[model samples]
Target: MKGRSRSTGLLLVISGASFWGVGGTVAQKLFQEFGISVDWLVTARLLTAGVLLLAVQFLLKDRSQVIGVWKNKRAAIMLLIFGLAGMLAVQYTYMASIHHGNAAVATLLQYLAPAMIIIYLVLRKQSVFSRQDFVTVSLALAGCFFLLTNGSVSQLSVPAPAIVWGVLSGVALAFYTLYAIPLLKEYDSLVVVGWAMVIGGSALSFIHPPWQMDFGSLSAEAYLYLVFVIIFGTMLAFWFYIESLQTLSPTETSLLSSLEPLAAVFTTVIWLNEPFGIYQWAGTACIFGMILLLALNKKKPAKSNDSVENEEPLRVS
Candidate 1:
């Protein structure tokens, strides 16, 4: 049973990552088709996703749980941060990074959050620095270099500002992933995510008022893509992510999720006819190899072996 649960959790994490990858690509495509700016897309996505999430939560949440969060102002505040920083900040920085740099470079640097997660875990004394961890980080970094440079070290240079913003986005992502874990202990993951979306989306909506949104201007395809982003990208992906956090360490989950970039690369190749150089292929190989190593090298606590469970904030602006 334990093994089955672990397997299911692994599957869920992978699926979540896959959803994120596809969602990103699809969102990019929507931008191309709809002639919408990233700012508008980001605004629309968060608004729609937040409303849908809150609707589901309100209909499905237990009365007792609702009362608990209502009274626990501390948890409510923390969750608001979770939405603002964890969700909105990361997404916003990702867009900023791309505008400041090339999309490929932005994407590569943004994923540096995995390394940040490992560092934070080590600092918190959450886990010892296993050789496997080091190897995974090294391999992942190598992959990023290859992916961005197309395997040529000569072409690897990114704009300094872009690199800085991308790394900062990564840092924000790490904190968001870390700080929110504790809140999951007290609230249902769905309710927590729902509330975070509502709060965070509200905060971001003020940046671009929904009153300005032109619903009549949207094409059928664009609207369909929006629904896809809200449902699969924001909702289900986060649900699986929080569920995986119950059984996986921050490092474990982050490393496993490194597959997301690889998924993106493949999508680009298939959809955009992007060519992969030898170095890019090598880096991709290393990233996947390292992920497998981390998965197999994980240590289960002897006392807590039967426990399937247990479940941040830094401003990244």
Candidate 2:
């Protein structure tokens, strides 16, 4: 039974991560082939997924948590900050990255969040700069260099705006991961994330109202893709990942989650026919190695807040 449970957990995590990766590719298709705006897609995805998640919480968990989170003044403030600055920022930046570049590059760039988190912790004196940390950071930087420049310092493989958005996506992702730890520890992950999504989506709605899109122009197939992004990519992906934690260790789950980038790379290359050079593949390998090192490290970083090892953030594409 134990073996069966572990296998199930592995499958759930892999499926969840793959959904997120492929979702990004579908999003790319929407942006390039169907002319969907990033703001519109982000707003629609957050609002729809957020509501659905809350509905699940209302049905299965404590219904009060759906609203109880806002009763506390401090939690409310933090939620607002997380929603606007962290969730909204991450979503917008990621979609913008996909809009400016392909999904493969965008997803790979966002995976740099782990390295950024290490740097942030070290600079704050929360963690020591061990040899492992050194290698991790070095590998991330080298990987990023190769990915962007394709082994040359002067030339870039992708556009300038894409690089900027991709890097910003990583920064936003780091903030999203770190900032959500407190909220996650306090309330259920679903409650915190769901509310954050709604808040973020609500704010973005003012900027780019979901109703503002041209509904008539969309084909049934395009609508199906959009539904896939919101349902499979955002909602189910998060749910599956969190569920897998019930049977697997956080380390195992985190390591398995590496399949996200692999899925993105494969789908982007095979389905979209995005050109990837030899240097780019090497860069991808370096990033994967860095992720593996971080996941395998047993020592938890000493910090004022809860350790990151206890909870992995929802990696919504």
All candidates: TM-score? 0.76, 0.97
Provide C-alpha RMSD values for all models, in order.
5.2, 1.3
Runs with alpha carbons beyond 4 Å of true place in candidate 1: 1-16, 61-63, 97-110, 123-127, 157-165, 240-259, 299-317
Top lDDT model: 2
Clashing pairs in 1: 179-312
Q: What is the Cα-based lDDT of residue 166 in candidate 1? A: 73
Residue lDDT tens for model 1, 173-236: 7777677766766777666666666666677667776567788998998878787766887777
Poorly placed runs, candidate 2 (over 4 Å): 1-3, 304-306
Candidate 2 whole-model C-alpha lDDT, 0 to 1: 0.90
Model 2 / residue 62 / CA error / Å: 2.3
Candidate 2 lDDT trough over 10 residues, lowest sum: 304-313
What lDDT does each candidate get? 0.65, 0.90
| lDDT, model 1, position 116 | 69
lDDT of 2 by residue, 175-212 (tens): 99989888887888888889989999999999999999
